[model samples]
Target chain A: MENIDFSLVDWSRAQFALTAMYHWLFVPLTLGLSFIIAFMETLYVKTGNSEWKRITKFWMTLFGINFAIGVATGIILEFEFGTNWSNYSWFVGDIFGAPLAIEGIMAFFLESTFIAVMFFGWNKVSKKFHLVSTWLVAIGSNLSALWILVANGWMQNPTGMRFNPDTARNEMVNFWQVLFNPVSINKFLHTISSGYVLASIFVIGVSAWYLLKNREHQLAKKSMIVASVFGLLTTAFVVLTGDGSARNMAKYQPMKFAAMENLYVGQQNAPLVAIGILKEDSKETLHKKQDFRFQIEIPNMLSYMAFLDPNAYVPGIKDIVHGNPEHNILSFQQRSEKGKIAIRALSDYRNAKKAGNDSLAKVSQATFEANYANFGYGYYAGRDVHELIPNIPMTFYSFRIMVGMGVHFGALFLVILLLTLKNKIDKKRFILYTALWTIPLAYIAAELGWIVAEMGRQPWVIQDILPTIAAVSQLKSTSVQITFWMFFILFTGLLIAEIRIMTTSIKIGPTEDLKDSVKN
Target chain B: MKEILFNIFQFYYQGFKSMTLGKKLWTIFIIKLVFIFLVLRIFFFPNVLKSNFKTDDQRSNHVIEQLTK
Candidate 1:
């Protein structure tokens, strides 16, 4: 702990988080809008309605603006993996690099290739070919997301890989297991569904703006209908996948699950905190207990959600840290000891091999294999046990924000859809205003979902396998800080440019030529 | 195959030539890519494992050292 440069770790984490959050802003819109545009284009081709084509082209333009900027932040994020977390790269690169490489080589190229056709092939290609290209772009972008989320899911749960004693790194054993890991599937579905919801909100919000201004009423109404229907269906899927993700979190990363609920004591029939305002606890009471100033909880809901059994025992922070014999949970201190033993065995194996002592090396190897599951805990052998606990307040609040906003968006979509169907949308300025204002909140909820996922799994870059302190590159803290600010300024600039260009395009409205063509 | 390839090439060429706002966006995209790959990556983001160690064995040894020491 004394030798570890905490400053470098903190700065690297900050820089990566900044870049990722910014990149996320554009990705969801691209994911969901591509499909929406394709659906509109499909309608245009079927009915030969120029009005549908105008709407398709209008949304496609915004998608292009977003897609370009997304690429910029995404490239920087990939580079940061090499620059800031080189140790992590080498340690698990064999397993981790596979999914990322597939994402880049397959999904990314697929998206990039067809995106041009979707954009510029409006007149150059046949209508059917162009429509196919649009759908392909949507599939390609989501495919890219699938591979990336698979990699992230692997990090959260870390399956289908084994540590190699000879290489001192984890390597892929079963590619299929890694790809189809339950965590990966849940994560992929949940993440993309949430993106779909965000994109739906974006379309509805923009269309609502036109309605509020009394411009392009037909186009706005049509778009709102398509978007609201798509949004409602995907929001249902988000809820289902969110439930699956929570179950996975409970089973695989109990510490993160505990922090999310701010549970301090182990219990059966643990209540789920629906909403809460947390009171600040002193450092002494931090892991022991958390005081919620106000909270609404559902009886036995947390237990049922986590394990499908309302009476099932759920271990909390204290139970995890102190070890619960009744629940058969090992304490962090105990795990750390096993980790140290594993670490010692590895060192001994290396020394024995160097000295050409085969028997000693074999014995040490066996010891390492036995205690390998707790290997990461070895890094905290003498450190504070409290470090095992993640940030309770941040995780708890972010989860609430994400889930609460998600429900609000669901209701908002339904209300807007009903109002639009009844032809009462124009009269209800309040609902229109709410739909318009929800654009930023949609983004906030999406970002908070990631905050809960990433931040809640704190201290571990790869859960249980490797702690973050050991995963960072041996670089000067100042270097990371410099790049952090550099990224902040550059990404901020690009975001402003995107917003300006998108708003200008929206204000221009659909071209008058399309309206004239429809009249003809 | 040759004619098909030519048609594909021609399609993209014509698309690129016909500029509205896309050309400006592409220019921004290309410029950002250049700056990122050529300048930032080359200057600040060297692959530590590849640069510091001459071989996989050496790299793995360095990681082991970091882990245990």
Candidate 2:
């Protein structure tokens, strides 16, 4: 408690964030693009349309580039668990490693092996076989995502695992419970559906560029239609999934929910902030320091969103940190005290075994079980309980930006679809230009959403059970610093090269591919 | 073998030179990345894992003891 190391923890977190941020840049594109390519290939097989095959090949080339880069950054991310967060790894590995292992053995192989077939089997295999390969690539990639999300979801809200004092680690007791966590399902669907929106926007943007250039007209028109339709469907799912994700956060991580909305007071029928700014001079606000400045709010929306009940009493940041016994919620300090009890009980149980006292051991074990739920609180008990409340302003703004982007994208996709229907896609030059630019905005939104999820869970890496400070590897900060630089250099170089190659390939276009296939 | 290699090099050489301001973009990109990842991290972030516990067992025990307290 007296001599806490801050540098090593900060550097390790920085390195992990760097790798994850880079990995994510490429992943959503791959997740969404794979399905688009598969659908195109399917239509090709169904209608025997050569144009469809060209579209598939054109996008396949880009997907390959994105997937290759994703793998490059993703490998670094997985290794970080062992190399940087060894303590968390050993503590939660029993339950955490299952989904990751399954992802590797089942999902990774399905995507990777068939990906080769999908890319190379165009001339080498039958049409149906190639189509199947394309579909497999899509299925495999999404399944891989599902498992990793399950692993992440478990970290966010640990369940199906029990702490063992003897081994000083948690052990898995229920695989099904871990696999089917509501947070995991919501996270998986919301995340992948966002990927779908991103991919559709990417497709539509590229097609829009082609229409603007007055090149590849027929191919561009059809691709835009498919992309716009795909965007529409996925954006619809994204809204529903986002709602589900917010609900799950309220249930499993009420603190995050409170911070995201910047709610400071416990109340029934809390209004959701439509848009608001945090008071900069909070100390001057005197009584209500963290309250938002002048803003728009929809009354009862937050309560209805968080809990289906319109009058459900929602606890705010203050209520969460202090006590809200009226709602049967213990203050964070009380939880910390309980966590300490759990820990002491476990220690007593261990000592009891040494003393050959069976009844004492049984009693201590029962006590440990009763209080273990607050185990994470014990680590932060001596510190300011207010620190358990994450960065309110950042979480609030990031959630708003992410949600705002999703809404804008949903509307944009509809407009694009309407223009396509009118058959005046090219005539609408201003909208076409807007479509071209929305590509980067979509990526920004996706990243902001992740920032909200991750940064909003600050202080705790394993939510309520383990603080991030207690979960890091016991390695020198210098080593992590060096590796951080190494990855920064490597991933950046790869990203630049990838863009150069991808843009060049895109500019070259699908015409040559069609000709080459026709000749063959 | 040398001729084939030369042809490959020739292809990439032209490709690189064909793009305007390619070198300038690369220079800016590398500079910004170094500043963000290395320079900025030094000023803004500090390593927290190194100061507290010297060994793995010590770290685990510290956490356990704290929880048990």
Candidate 3:
């Protein structure tokens, strides 16, 4: 721990966060719009409507521009896994690299190939073939999302694998368990559906702006109608899967859920904080007398969300950090103690094996097996694991913002959905304005969701299995700092270019006809 | 469904076959992508963990020493 340079870790984190946040800005739109464009292309093929073709091509043009820049930044992550977190690469690369490699071979290749065809196949190929290409591109993009998230989920709950001390890494034993991990599946659904919601909002918001401008009424209205209906369905799925995600969190990482709610003491039928602000650090509050300065909580909602039972006992940060006898929750100190023994036993076992002392090796193996579950905490030998608690204030607020934004998006889409049903969307000026304004809200919520997911799980690179400190590469902090700023500045310029290109394309609306522009 | 996919694949195969200029351009694209993603990766990013410890016993020993240190 002392050998790990703090600055190096911080700089590497900053670089990864910068690239990930930037990568996300483009990805949700790509994931969501790919499906929307496919639907539009299907409409064109089915009804033989050139207008739908125009609409699809128009969105496709924006997608292409975004896709190019997204690829340019996306490559940075794969490189960083080795360069920035070299230890992490070696430690878990056995399991983690599988999904990434599969993503490249299966999803990335499929996506890049069909995307070329989807973009350039217009005039060259038959309309049917072109339509197929569009759908394949959508599937390819979302499939790419699935594998990456599966990897992330494995980190959150390291199931389907076993630690091999000899190899000094986690190795996968059951690919199916890794693939079908409850957390991974739920996260995939929730994340991809959120993307759909974001795309819906983007499309509807842009269309509303056009409606506000009194231009492209047909395209705007049609897009708004399609996006709103689709947005509503996806939003519903997002909520369902979000519940599954929270429950998974409560089971595997209760500390995160406790932080999200700012609950200091364990309680039966724990209330969910709809919105709350943390109080100034007072001895009483920190020690579990009272936690929040102000809060609006719904009775039993947190318990319900976590366990599907209103009366289920939910552990809080205090209960979790300290041993809770009644709930049988081991304190961080206890786990830390056990983890130390496990780590030491592994060392002893290695030594005994080298010396050909079978009896000593067997005893060491037994000790290692007994305490292996707490092995990660062994690294923080002299301190309580409670000290490793994530930033409560940041995690708490980010969780609320994500949930609050989700509710707002869900409601906004439903209103638009209802209005579309009534065929009165064009007349609703207030709704149109709200839709236009809420576009940024969607982006904010999307970013906040990631903040909550990543930030809330902090101090651990892999939840309960590996702390971030142990995962970073031993490298000069200054080099990482230099690259962080380099990427930051470069991505900032790309963002400005992306915005300019997208806005201009949207303003131009669908090309008059796909005839001349469809040149191969 | 398999037959439909096969037909689609055939269409693409023949489409690439007939286009002399497009085929040449695509070949370059494939080569560049493979070089950038695969070839460069080996030199720039070697797995230090795997290379440093030659065996399970050695790797385990290193972890133990580091943790205790």
Q: How close is candidate 3 to the true structure, as a TM-score?
A: 0.89
- Best-fitting candidate, measured by TM-score? 1
* Model 3 score (lDDT): 0.80
Scored by Cα lDDT, where does model 2 land? 0.80
- B5 in model 3: Cα distance from truth in Å? 18
What 10-residue stretch in candidate 2 chain B is worst by lDDT?
A: B42-51
How do the candidates rank by lDDT, highest first? 1, 3, 2
lDDT of 2 at A519: 54
Candidate 3 clashes: the total is 1
lDDT-best of 1 and 2: 1
- Give the per-residue lDDT of model 2 (tens digit) for A1-520: 3455779888988898888888888899999999988888888889977888888878887887677555635655656775677667667857877787888887657976687578656665689888998998898889889998998899899999888775567889999999899999889999998998999999888888988999888777788888888999999999999899989899989989988888888789988899998888787432233866778999999999999888988888878887888998888889989977876788898779779999999999999889878877877768866668787778899999988888888888899889888898889999889898999998999899888999888878898888877777667889889878877887788788768867886788874467665554
Q: Write the per-residue lDDT of candidate 1 for residues A142-244, one digit (tens) a residue.
A: 9989888998999998889888877877889999899999999999999999999999999999999999999988888899899999999999999999999
Flag the better candidate by TM-score, 1 or 2: 1
lDDT (tens digit, per residue) of candidate 3 on A1-520? 6566778878888888898998899899999999999998898889976777777877777777677656646777777887777667767846888998888887657986887688657767899998898999999889988999999999998888877666667789999999999989999999999999999999999989888898887778788878988898999999899899999999998988887777778899889989887766756644333367788889999999999999999998888888798989998888889988997898888789889999998999899879988878887777545546777788788888888888888888889878877778888999999999998888888888888788888778888767877777776788778767767876787787678867877877776554543432
**TM-score of the B chain in each candidate versus the native B chain:** 0.94, 0.43, 0.52
Candidates, DockQ? 0.75, 0.09, 0.23
- Candidate 3 stretches with Cα past 4 Å from truth are A2-4, A281-290, A384-386, A421-423, A514-520, B1-68
Model 3 chain A, poorest ten-residue lDDT window? Answer: A511-520
